[model samples]
Target: MKERKGLIIGSVIMIAIFVLMFIKGEPSKSIMVWIAAILTLSIYSFLYKDNVFYKFAEHLFVGVSVGYSVSVVWQNAFIRRVFDPLFITRTYIVNDKFSLYLFLGIVIPTLLGLLMLSIFTKKQAWLIRIPIAFVVGSYAGMGIAPSFQANIFEQTRSTLYVTLSISASIMIVGVISTLVYFFFSKEHKGLLGKTANLGIWFIMIAFGASFGYTVMARISLLIGRMQFLLHDWLGVIK
Candidate 1:
């Protein structure tokens, strides 16, 4: 009963927001802005308790966003940017001059769409492999270039450097330190071991600083949302 009440109340507040903005408001644009603000803030109400209300609202929001994106893409990109340019060329239009790349753009998506249809048919399952291979090949090519640059080259570049920048020196020391820390393979009891211990501290401090910065950014967003609700939504502040 309590959960139901919360759900009902929350839905009413949400509906009121939409009604105020869309059906009966002067400067509907301003009301729409507040409606968005209130709806966004409502998600945080989950921290207070578990309820069916929150679940429904969350799923509803996700469905709406997905549907909206598909609608916008159809209305704007597919109709205006693509369909209009390709098939509907009228006055001063040269269909014979159309680029082959535009055909590839259509075919690639069409191929993927066809591959997805294969899932619904038992005999056509083999057709899925082409799109899968294309996607995987593209991903592997992207992954290998970055892995080579960062892990392979950057990690080993210090040994060949005649003069080092601060960043390079840091990287070199980090590499040397890691090597020393793993000296269980032999024995690191000299200055090498000591340098490795210092490197371990640098790694720890770097991670800690990164974590602290992330927390500060999230807190800043929270404060901004509060200010919006108080000042802009309510008109309670000058």
Candidate 2:
């Protein structure tokens, strides 16, 4: 009964707003603008309670995002990298002569890709492992150096760079204490126990800051939608 009453109230408010816009000659002429307004409202309806409108908007957003991603990958990655080089332009032919280096580079990867489709066949299912292993091994090899450089080396360098500063001293202590807290080899006793307690305080402060940042980002998105509705759609604000 409460849900029904809330739904009716929401519907009346939406209709009243649209009617007012119509009266003021401020109704959006663009079909796309109307669609955007409706979808935005549908998503925002979840603030009151979950309903069919919110679900529809959620599903539509996900579906459109996935479809767009696939289309982009197909056009930009596969078509440009694989198809165009192999069959269309035949760029593997260096000068007027065939280049073994270019040929192997393209053909080998293409064969491995085709091997992935072998999973569809019962007898050839094991063949898929070959490409899978290759992909995993190559990606891990490629990712390791960059990830280590960024996450470890760069972070450590930045942390210790301004060692004289108060913030840097706190970060240095935080890093050391946090490392000690995770060192479970010996029982945390005496000084170790004290350090670990300090680590807990640092960890809680970091987590609280991260959570607050995330909340502010979400609130910013909400404010953006409100601005769009008030200024662009309703013409209530310039």
Candidate 3:
């Protein structure tokens, strides 16, 4: 009963809005605006109650997002990296001659990519693991050295070697306490326990700040949507 009433009310409101928009708004742009408005309202309908409108909007959003991502990847990754460099520029070859080394550079990765499609077949499913392992190992090798330098060495150097000040001293204390809290070799008792307790305070403060930042970001997005409806669609704000 409640769901039926809500749906009827929503339909009536949407129809009335569309009629008003069609009468007042420009024909071509108004049609697009109407669609944007409907989709936005459909998404917001979830806040009131779960219904077909919300589901439709969610599925449409996911489908469009996935389609756009695939197009972007194909153009940027494959077309630019593989097609342009090999066929157009032919930068990998010299004197219009075949070079095994140059050709293998592109061929090996291309073959590995094609092998990924073998995952659909039961017998050749194992071929997919070769490319997957290559991708994982390549990323790990590329990422580890820089990550170790930035996260470990640089942070340690900054914490220990930074000029002494109130803020720096606080940071130093926080780092030590946090490390001590994670240290399980010695039991967290007496002085160690107090330091660990201090670490808990620092952790909670960090978490609270992060949560507040996230909340503010969400609120900003909500404000943007509301502004669009009011100022852009309804012309209620300048």
On TM-score, the leading prediction is 2
Of 2 and 3, the candidate ranking higher by lDDT = 2
1-238 per-residue lDDT for model 1 (tens digits): 9998998898789768755654443432487766666576567667657666677668879999999999998888667655665567522244656556766666566568568669778998888888888888989999999999998797567455737588777766776777677667665667877877877787788799999999999999888876665456554444
Among residues 3 or more apart in sequence or in different chains, the pairs in candidate 3 whose N, CA or C atoms overlap within 3 Å are: none
Choose 1 or 3, whichever is better by lDDT: 3
Give the Cα lDDT of each candidate.
0.71, 0.89, 0.86
Q: List candidate 1 stretches off by more than 4 Å.
A: 1-29, 72-86, 90-105, 120-126, 150-171, 179-200
lDDT (tens digit, per residue) of candidate 2 on 1-238:
9989998998899879767865775655778877898999899889778999999999999999999999998899779889999899988997799998998888898899889999999999999999999999999999999999999999988887875988888999999999888999989999999998899899999999999999999999999997877667766666
Candidate 2: the clashing residue pairs are none
Off by over 4 Å in 2: 1-25, 118-123
Report, for all candidates in order, the number of backbone clashes. 0, 0, 0
* Best-to-worst lDDT order: 2, 3, 1
